[model samples]
Target: MSGHKRFWKAVSVAQENGLFEPRLDGRPIRLPQGKVLAVRSSALAEAIAGEWGQIAEGASFTPDSLPLTRMAGTMIERIAPDPQTTRDMLLGFGVDDGLCYCADGINPVAEQVFAWLSGYGIHPSVTDGLMPVVQPEGYLEAVGQLLATQGDLDLAVLGVLAQATGSLLLSLAVVGGAVSLVDAVLWANNDEKSQLATWGQDDELVRTMENREKDILDAGMFLTLGRQVSI
Candidate 1:
């Protein structure tokens, strides 16, 4: 007998209007806004259902336990409804992109970031950590346009990545396959790692970094699964 007392005995996917819906005990799951949760990718729907199915009935759990579900809900309830707001929020990160800020006048990862952005015709200005770097108007416009091209799901995933890493460039790099998720995490935590080297390692800080890495990886998986075509 399974100790996991799940609320739903079975999980299934329903196809409607070319979108997939995950059902709990034959009832469609609804988002926070009361809309039935549906996604363009059947794979994503299944993954979301898997999260729900894994929940133990009468067992404690939080939103953090359901990353895929939370992301899918975000796509439906937030990003899909007002894409411009989300796009602008993501673009805002570029204005003071973490990669552009160099402490001690040196950022080892800046050259790689520059090369990645070059593919999209964006050349951002870099500056020492002392002052904020104002990105060019053209660069902002280009980044906005690039973000606009992303679908709701991609935007949602990018939002997670940007929030986790605090750098739109690193998020975009992950999306564009310009860098591995490992590299992105490493680059994003470069300053912190440098500090850890100077100061003794703090267990709490290390734990926080590990959680952040997991979030980034989860976002990457969500993006990949969401892009898959249902057979």
Candidate 2:
């Protein structure tokens, strides 16, 4: 089966089990829901790797032409490149200015990441609870919300969404937390029906989810920032 179809199948399963009604940021997302999203996304990531590879292929600009942070800086600047041949090279992954690109909502790193992913055809927006929530512009707040509710099943749904949208990086953020949350739930699912059982098992689940909280924080600090910070 095609990648897109497979992705949709995943979503269908998730939804059938009451998992999701995909949402891109705030608006409802109905196209290419699951595995298809993952395949296209992988294709996009490979494409980005290819484009960067080509750029660094034969050219080696000196410190003047290429500063210490050359790659990171140039990549950041190219968030909105001049239209031309390279446009196709990126395959439409990028931002087109947010609600107010220059206003309080404008964040260069977040915008660049958003644009880059969108360029590859992944649409990202705010998601809260069971709805595709839309945040103002900051990436941290939205991500925090998803992570905050890790045990609520939203994280898994969001993971499926991230997989579909081809945001593996972001998926990492959600999945890392969601997996533990799901595991905790499964553990609780095994407990008895009595109050004592609920207290013991439910508390264990909360503790498990809480312990992994740092994973989400780490993701926020590193993944949300991107490759520059690592350097």
Candidate 3:
């Protein structure tokens, strides 16, 4: 019942400037707008090729099934539209990082969050108010430095992960090998998870956490898969 048809007999990857390009039938693939489809990651390129390779002679594929390739396109078409826009977006994630907040308790989850913050060179000081105040002076510069070499797609997914985790630092931790994707998500939701544990779970909170978990996993796994890339 698939309406897709394969008109090409072969799919291959070509290298360019430390990036990878997908080729079909000895010709490089193009975007829907006829622009060249390229990626800065070998693993990602191979993954895209695998998507195309999986299509049977008569089978069709959908965008939903090709998230990796779609993200590559989105990177070129949307995320890195301009240098200023990307910089601003990167700064947005650093403004209100999740690690800057505390749960007002001595629980293990909160303690763990404090530990990661300390590891990242952030030291919290007791304030005059009822809450602890922390400023991530180094977070902005670190994330911006990360953006220096990251292609559009990398920034796009990092933004997604940052928003999902409510902490650019955590997302960077995921990208920088400081923590696993699942651990990052679990930590991001630590406060809520702890609260929900004793108070009971509500549909809204549960659903929100579920979606965040999925986004974190998708973005984090994509980054992990790209780790093998030579660049």
TM-score of each: 0.90, 0.18, 0.67
Evaluate model 3: give its lDDT: 0.68
Q: Higher TM-score: candidate 1 or 2?
A: 1
lDDT of 1 by residue, 166-186 (tens): 989878878887778888788
Ranking by TM-score: 1, 3, 2
lDDT of each: 0.83, 0.31, 0.68
Q: How does candidate 2 score on lDDT? A: 0.31
Expressed as tens digits, the lDDT of each residue in 132-152 for candidate 2 is 344346444343432443431
Best by TM-score: 1
lDDT of 3 by residue, 90-209 (tens): 667666655556446444543554566566555433233445355546755655665576665567677778778777666665665666776777776776787799889688888888
Worst 10 residues of 3 by lDDT: 123-132
Task: For candidate 1, give the lDDT.
Answer: 0.83
Residue 136 in model 1: shift from native, Å? 3.0
Q: Evaluate residue 22 in candidate 2 and report its C-alpha lDDT on the 0 to 100 scale.
A: 28
Best of the two (1, 3) by lDDT: 1
Query: Is candidate 1 or 2 superior in lDDT?
Result: 1
